[model samples]
Target: MGGLEEWKVLGGEGDQAFPCLEKLSIQWCGKLKSIQVLFPALKELTLSGMGGLEEWIVAGGEGDQVFPCLEKLSIERCGKLKSILICGLSSLVEFGIEKCDELRYLSGEFHGFTSLQLLRIQDCEKLESIPSVQHCTTLVELNIRSCRELITIHGDFRELRSSLKKLVIGNCRLGALPSGLQCCTSLEELWIVSWGELIHINDLQELSSLRRLSINGCDKLISIDWLGLRQLRYLVKLTIMWCRSLSYFPEEDCMGSLTQLRELDIGGFSKELEAFPAGLVNSFQHPNLSGSLESLWIYGWDKLKSIPHQLQHLTALKGGGATIASDLESIGNEIAKKCGGLPLLAKVLGGTLHGKQAQEWHLILNSRLWDTEDGNKALRVLRLSFDYLSSPTLKKCFAYCSIFPKDFRIEREELIQLWMAE
Candidate 1:
């Protein structure tokens, strides 16, 4: 049963043909054309990488049967499979399909699935659309990603919205957002990414219960309508990244109204900007806004020169006798400490002697020495550490680690095995 790679073994042909198997996996069996596996107690089944498999049918005692006790099923990377005909699976809850390019249809009828809860489809490039679920009332979560040919989603999504709390779609050519998604009052998180032609953000106005929202890599996006987001009073985190055409942040008092907003990350905006807005940093320090605001990351601003002076109040290091000017210097000093020593500050101090020494240690400990000009300086520090290891046994043990690939984690067991083999 373990290593019989190529032998046609029928289910009822043998006297005792694995009737107690609750889980079965058939992998890399190149000549397997058909499977009539009938395990009455089977709850989970997985078929993967079997190249010659063209069809599969599960039969009942004598006629068409239903897997009344099956809970999970997975089909992956089988190129010849064209469709999965569900005869009867009354207890199935979760189903997953991946990388099967030739699969064009999921099943003959969608109403057969009465208890399915989660359906995930990924990387099946030839799949055009999902089968409509007319009878699946208990379904909750649906995730579709990287199916390039899938352009449309049909059927009433609102029917599942009452129980479906999470929905994610990414890397598909979907051109418009589905309507009536706002009725899902129980939805907490929503995410959309890499839909090339998506230009509208107005469809997000209906999500009143959404606490977290993220949109990234949608190149054609132009603006965000803050008026539509007024109902999202409980929103905590908002992130918008890699939107090339986004020129402006919401007007000063726009995001200030979200009293519950805690974190904001607006990075990779490909436009040139001179500086942040005047009252922008001050808003983070406002009494109502200050209590919830914790982290802010703004990157990819090519023309950004410095942080605003008011940002000093937002740092945790500000305390008694520490004026704004002094606190600013303290923050800069902390960053310099983390960098070992500031190259800019070292140049102003007349030379980089101390800076060079600090940089060398930083490179050696972090193991980033050989990847840049600073690596040569890091190598000098690493050699110094090696010089102290004069013991032959310790030196040989450390030298053996060099055989591993760069950035590899050298486990204690692997080192012991290498030594034993030697």
Candidate 2:
């Protein structure tokens, strides 16, 4: 349908056309201005690069249903589309619109979509507001980003609090977070990034169910309510980066209270902040942190000269600060070659050997796994690395990971809970 100027009615004047068509995609139809066809059985419809489309008119009549079974609809790069009027999409479960430059407002209420789970809108510079989701009880994920004119999200979150699991808001023009966000207690993952006007992050104490929280690229953010963070006791992974104006650090006593935190990542601070947070760096042996912290990653600290010496006390750390002897360079290279140029294996081996002695590195380089002819070199080396785990529980955890498919992004807290249940 590329370069098509118009799509005529399918079949005949009163015929039920394409009643069984399940999927249809129209791409680069630059001259198409309107689509009035009926797809009674369509489950997915995609329209992309529709350069001249100005309208999608719905056939209005008694008992007429268009796209009655559509579960997913995606529209992208339709630069001239000003409005979307087609209705009867109550079955839409996932709706995404991106790069529709001329779209300003969605026309109807989305609460009719009882089965809707994911809605994503991005890169629509003219879009000011989206339809309310106040009654969309089954909505599981909402992602809105790069809509420069969108100043606020409209709707209460009480209906979404029970089902919404992931929420991502980024690169928008809102000066503050939406007022209803505090009510989404069921949200498990939240990311706020690339926002320029937000100066403070307050009122998140009620998100007790949050497991992963990331705040990045908010240039003007100066402080977070640490009291609120202390209340999110279920949070396991936290990342804060590229927030050059943020100067506040949690108090020393606060780290000891976050008993469930496992991973912490902080970096890209301004140079005026000469050192890492004393609470995190100076007090690594805090009882809770020593027992719970498993991974710590810090980078882009241009002014800091060395890592904290006390970090060695964290026995649970799989990868944090490690000092390799200058003498181990050749042995390290040999071990790296045995990794078969696989970066994942290299990363795993490095994390496994973090804070180990020089003799340990040599022992790996000379292990019989390298001499075994029965398996791939990388697999043999990976097995050898797995055998080096000092804790039986840690080894069991690693073995349990084999149940997941390769490259699966397993959630850390969920894995911990599963291990506990085991």
Runs in model 1 deviating more than 4 A are 1-19, 54-64, 80-88, 101-109, 133-135, 248-252, 270-286, 302-422
Residue pairs with backbone atoms closer than 3 Å in model 2 (clashes): none
What RMSD value applies to candidate 2?
A: 10.5
- Please tell me which predicted candidate would have the highest TM-score against the true structure: 2
lDDT of 2: 0.77
Can you write out model 1's per-residue Cα lDDT over 1-422, one digit (the tens) per residue? 32344443454542146557776666666567655445566788777876676665554342114354678888888888777765557777888888887876665545666788888888888777776654566777777887777777766666666676667777777766655566666667777788766776775566767888788887877666656665677788887777776665554544656678777765555456566544456565666555666666554445556656655555432132111121222333443443445354333222222213334334433544334454454454455455545587777787888899763445678898887787
Backbone clashes in model 2:
0
What TM-score should be assigned to candidate 2?
0.71
RMSD in angstroms, all models?
A: 10.9, 10.5
